[model samples]
Target: RVFDVLVEGQLAIPALDLALEAGTYTAVSRQYTVKVSDGQLNVRFATRQGATLVNGVRVSERPDKALP
Candidate 1:
């Protein structure tokens, strides 16, 4: 399945296919840097091909190391 993710109403992840990147039932992760103007953080997922599914979501401060 494929989908798009939006954070704070802006596009963050586009055309994500979990089964193609990682095998079914495997874990895959993606991280993005976004500034929170408001106290709330919104994450929205839209299906591109099939139904979109998410296992979990995590929110934390940016790490010292930069993302590769």
Candidate 2:
């Protein structure tokens, strides 16, 4: 699950800490890679699934602010 993401001018997240704790493995960190490409920016998403919270705090909102 993506807890948070931030991009600038439609950039990419070079490095992010990700983990999988399913049947795939008890736990694994930084074993995945994320890629960002153009022509498909500002993709719209629905909130019909309601809100996703982490540690009792909301964090499902997609990033919209530009990074320097």
Candidate 3:
């Protein structure tokens, strides 16, 4: 499946395809940095090709070890 990830209504990921990147049935981890000005974090996935599939999502405070 292919889709676009939008953070704060802005395009973050143009097209994400798990099958192409990690193959079927494989787990992949992705991280994105976004600043929430309205105190709300909105994550939306817009379908580009097929259906959108997401196993999980994690949100946390900016970690010093994580790159921006």
Candidate with best TM-score: 3
Please provide, for model 3 over 1-68, each residue's C-alpha lDDT reduced to its tens digit, 9 standing for 90 to 100: 89999999999989988899889999888877877888889999999998887888989988673545
TM-score of each: 0.82, 0.17, 0.84
- Put down candidate 2 lDDT per residue, 1-68, tens digits, no spaces: 43333332432432223433343224432222223455333422222233422332122323653323
Model 3 lDDT on a 0 to 1 scale: 0.87
The lDDT of model 2 is: 0.32
What lDDT does the true structure give each of the candidates? Answer: 0.86, 0.32, 0.87
By lDDT rank, best first, the candidates go 3, 1, 2
lDDT of 1 at 63: 68
Per-residue alpha-carbon lDDT of candidate 1 for residues 1-68, written as tens digits (9 for 90 to 100): 89999999998889988899888999987777887778788999999998999989999976653444
Which candidate, 1 or 2, would have the higher TM-score against the true structure?
1
Give RMSD to native, each candidate: 3.2, 11.1, 2.7
